[model samples]
Target: MVHDQYMSLSLVNINITSYCMQFIDSLCYILVILGLVGNILGLLIFSSSRHTSKISSVYVYLATSSSIINIFCVIRYALVLHSKTRIIINNLIGHVWFACKLYELSFCFRLISSWIILFWMFERVTCVSKRLRTLFYRWNASQLKFIIPCIIIFIILGCVIGPPAYMYQPRISKNKLSNSTIKSMNYFCGLPSTVSIKWQKYFNELHLGLNHYTIRCFFSELFPAGTIIIFNSYIMYYLFRTSYQFSQINENKITKERQRTTSWMNIVLILHSCLFLSSLFSHVVGHFLSVEAHETWWVLLTVLGNCSLNFYVYCLSGKAFRKQIIHIIQRLIILISYKLQTCKQQQQNHQYDNFKIENLIYQSNHVENINQPKSYGTKNYPKTIGINSSSPISEQETSV
Candidate 1:
């Protein structure tokens, strides 16, 4: 009875795991598609000549950040999908080294994406604080030049830290058959674990404790979150203080407009940072806490949802972003309507031409019939139309 109950519980666990995995797979697929499109649109909006003209040139940082998020989303989803399938696992286990490297690459992308956001927030802060601008004016002017080098530097940093952060280990467990000394080994790609027992102590101390708990939790997440919050608070204070002074004096249209734009930009940045922080916390909870498989899956879905929802957040938060989206939609609608009208016109023209050709062919055939000679039993007669009379045919009558 106990054995049967144990078997049933094991089966239940298996079913739950399968369901959770399927749910994760579906969500990841959705997130991957959304993240690709959203981030691409973000890049276009941030990089557009007209959009950038109105806003600070620092927005280029956002475009770069979107690009990084796109890569991170793709890599993260690929890893999730890879883990869910036995076929993929079997294939990947054969090349464990490559799989490990791919995992490391994904970690690097995620890290880089977060750090890029932090850098962008720093630039925003510099733009808001006059004192910082004095110090960072040249820095802001040369930001375009630094974007590439900054990305390269971050990539190198990620690569250096990524390898130690996570270690992939393929496990082979031996199972002994009943009444037999022989044991069969089952090889499978398993969860991330220490590379070997010999290095377990060092791995836990350095990689898990120092690298993950300290660097990842703090610098990648906590420090950035705190800094962004502080920066945005300072910006809000500066904006309100300036606006109060402007009200006390004569209203300047140019300064007011700039303030409004900055306010809208701040809204977007704040909301984006919130989503990022939420995802970061979700990641920590899902991985570090002892939770059910389905719960972990839900947590991950939330993380990916953050990656996919940034464009929507921008649309909701920023007036300029919303306007750009509206403009693009309007342009697309007009283009589609024009193309449809053109197609309709072309079809109508085709039909009219066909009618004209058919009419000409009918007229030509009638004329040929009129010119041809006709035989009537014992007498030859001419075929005529619009006249009902039996008359002998003449050359003039036939010609007429």
Candidate 2:
């Protein structure tokens, strides 16, 4: 009797898992396609337009990459949408597992990426200071903008890729579904099973659990995310105050640069703040909430926490990017409409020419028969219209 019930529960759980995955797959597919198109357009426009050639373009590059990371995550989600086993314990979790892990890591890295954007933009403001101006002028004058993006990319690459490869699986806590959770939930939802490992013990000699779940969040989620929030928050406050000094008339040139920097900073701040807050909320809620609630919507909140907001940043802050997006959308619309008109015009013109040709043929035939004794109608024959060919003309001739 017990074995039969166990089998039945597993069957129901598996069915729920499959349905949940299908829903996630559909959601990710839409976001991935849109994000890939949008971010690529952003990059292409920024590269061509001279508006952001200054050091700040370096920062825009970082912001662009964060969206790109989201695009990558969604693409991986697409490939594994059919997965049924929740938290499959394998020797080493590959792309599917990494995709889930990366989704969380993207949250923290987004803050880092956001900071670089604000940093680069703020540098533009600082460059106007007589003291700081020369350093940046020298930096740009020497084409050192490459260094900023390179460093940020290295940090991001290290944050996501390096840690897991070296660290191995610590401890992951798996929650057995409670009767209440199973009753309330229609799907299988698993949190990052808590595996506690003390970072201090790993780095130093202190004794702490390795399989605990919070450590992963501490190092990967909380630490990096907290650093980003604190660092950028201070920068944002200073930027706001400095921006108000724009009302002062003595330093108009500096003020303009500051305003641009401040505006971009505000955008960066808001995006990161929302992301950080959402992630924090989801993490806290998941740790405390029922398994069903965490599995169903909380995970989605966590996955989409940072990724969806990037389009907002690019659209609002980067003029070059926004213009390029507008141009591409306009170009797509034009291409669709342009061919329709061209085809319609061509058909009308073809019919008009054919009608004229027939009229001429009728009149000429009438004239030829009337003058049949002496007239050859060949000379008056309307010249055949020139034929267009893909291959080049090989011959030209007078008729034999």
lDDT of each: 0.59, 0.51
Residue-level lDDT of model 1, residues 1-400, one tens digit each, is: 1111101000122232576677767777777887877777677677774755454665575555656675576556445443344245444653476664464355455545655666666666766677777765655555543666477646655645554434544556567979999997655433345356544433232222443333544554566667667776776777678776776687688778866866776676678768767866765554344222212444446656766776677567656777887777798799999999999999999999999999999999999999999865745333543343445444445657
Cα RMSD (Å) per model?
9.3, 14.9
Per-prediction backbone clash count: 0, 14
TM-score of each: 0.65, 0.51
**Candidate 2: worst 10 consecutive residues by lDDT?**
1-10
Top TM-score hit: 1
Candidate 1 deviant stretches above 4 angstroms: 1-37, 49-51, 54-58, 64-68, 71-75, 78-100, 138-208, 211-220, 243-270, 290-299, 348-400
lDDT against true structure, model 2: 0.51
Q: Per-residue lDDT tens digits of candidate 2, residues 236-305?
A: 7767776886656556777888788688868776785566567656654544443322233454435453
Q: What's the distance in Å from true for residue 147, model 2? A: 5.9
